[model samples]
Target: MEPAPGLALVVVSPRVAPGLMSRSAWQVVEAASVRLCADADEPLAVAVTDADLPIQVYAAGSPALLARHLVERAADDNVVWLGSADGDEGLSDAIADEVSRLNDPPPVEVVVGSWDVPGARLLDVVAVMDRLRSPGGCPWDAEQTHESLLPYLEEEAGEYAEAVRSGDRAHMAEELGDVLLQVAFHARVAEDHPGQPFDIDDVAGGLVDKLVRRHPHVFADVEVSTPEEVAANWQKIKEEEKARRPGAH
Candidate 1:
């Protein structure tokens, strides 16, 4: 599918609850890229004053400990939440930090805000940015043309391929993220043109949905004994789909 142009911000927030973090003690806030840690002696109490920033707590070994700390140190105006350790909740849907379990009473001055930091949907980002760039957005990103971005996309793809060949997991991860950025950048560009469903969500969502529809064994009841059988099934489905197209051989 063709790509469109858009922008996104990666933010980290404080982990509200904890279970196990002797391993990796960092977590990202869904709305903004603010990281929170309980292991550090110096609390980021002053830093959490930003009203726009989202909070995400990592409940590694002790949920109570993390929750109490956030409750005590968090600004009264700042929003906080005690969420599950898993990445199940987005920055916008998190619960507030003020409410506490009766078992452990911690000094609390911060009051909870009902408002949660709403996460920006992928499609929403595209639609909003497109509107902004329409004789309205900043001159730089708005002035960019598709051809100008081709080099960047090519560079990112090459880096991804090289990273894969190198067998360095970290490099591969970084490269893959850059490739994603390229996809988003291209989508944003296509969106500027007419007669196109140019958006990053459409590109990503279509690919995900297509993969699930194509892989019946993984998404549906269909089963296969061998890789050859799987390939045959996929081919049959593709041929049937092609037959419905305007031209097929």
Candidate 2:
């Protein structure tokens, strides 16, 4: 007799763009006899249907009910469950409980469809800063100007320096985060500037451009024997960059 069909639970990161999924995720989801999700409007669900695959939108009930339904369905048909961005709270444990009650439960696997890349959390920081400055968010955050935030930025920098001096790794990380928050806050404030406006991406992009341009030893063929040589090369690059700027003498 053929082995019973199994269930594939596909989890995707909200940080990642929709429709971009791992090969394994696509394969399992494509091979499944039935695709299920709680919401038809979810990015993953929409992506799946956009690819011409059929997906059923079930009314989201309690975790236990959903788990029981999934296991029962998977007993006869291969099933793919597109998990919610918030992780379908407690659903996995409920599924485990339901599976344990059966004499012969279908095999279940969790497939990671998309994962956060390095620096993905920085996106969250930007999002939070936007929220804090928006109309309905914190009044203090919404009212803060770049000039008003300068003192806090300086204070945070000092705290970070002290953290480094004390050799407290945890404190250093926390202080560094505070410094980053100031950067985000200032960027958000800049968005409201009447004369000139720029977001965090602009700030980050400029920094990235400068880093790539200055680091010849790392990014280009320039060779440096020692730290002093690297510094001298950096200074030379800085002067060259200054000269090339529109207003440079």
Candidate 3:
């Protein structure tokens, strides 16, 4: 006899934008007779109530224990497991091991309810900066101009350098975020430029172009044997690009 099938439908990055769940994920959540969640105050719980699904909190236990609890439900009906922002990979692993031990293990399907675009979280920084610089935002942030933010940009860069020297990963992350904040802030402020206005996407687009143009070895058919050769190629490409300018002599 074939073992019954079970599901571990995990919600990914739901907290990035509270309740950013996919339709298919919601359908599974709605259809499942038994829904299990890690916490009630989490974004998943909010989504569950929104979906009108009966969700129960999971007790603290080993991954194998959790897997057994969920697969047991599979014997009678479908199971939906709502995961946290970071996911529960350990539980997934436990489920796989537990299934192997069972005489007639149920088939397990792991479903990702949502997907985050690569570097999508950085876009959130841009959005928040836009809000801060817009009307009815923080007075301090709204009053800031490109010139006013220059000092902060320098300060953030220095802090990031310090983090690198100290070799503290957490500090490095925080300092890097501060530097990114300055970039996003400047991009937001640039929108007010009378001659030519641009946003964060424009900034990133230019970077992408420069990266692609300089890294011919990676993006094109050009080959380089060493990092030094790659650097030389980058300099040559940059000079060629600069020479193309109308004012270049």
Per residue, candidate 2 scores C-alpha lDDT tens digits across 61-174 of 699999999999999999999988778999999999999999999999999999999999999999888999998999999888888999999999999999999999999999
Task: Assess each prediction's global lDDT (C-alpha) against the native.
Answer: 0.51, 0.91, 0.80
Candidate 3 achieves a global lDDT of: 0.80
Candidate number with the higher lDDT (1 or 3): 3
Weakest 10 consecutive residues, lDDT, candidate 2? 1-10
**Which runs in model 2 stand beyond 4 Å of their true positions?**
1-4, 243-249
Model 1 sits at a Cα RMSD from the real structure of 15.4
Tens-place lDDT per residue, model 3, 124-194, is 68768888888898899988889999999999999999999999999999999999999999998889899
User: What residue pairs clash in candidate 2, if any at all?
Assistant: none
Question: For each candidate, what TM-score against the reference?
Answer: 0.47, 0.92, 0.61
Better of 1 and 2 by TM-score: 2
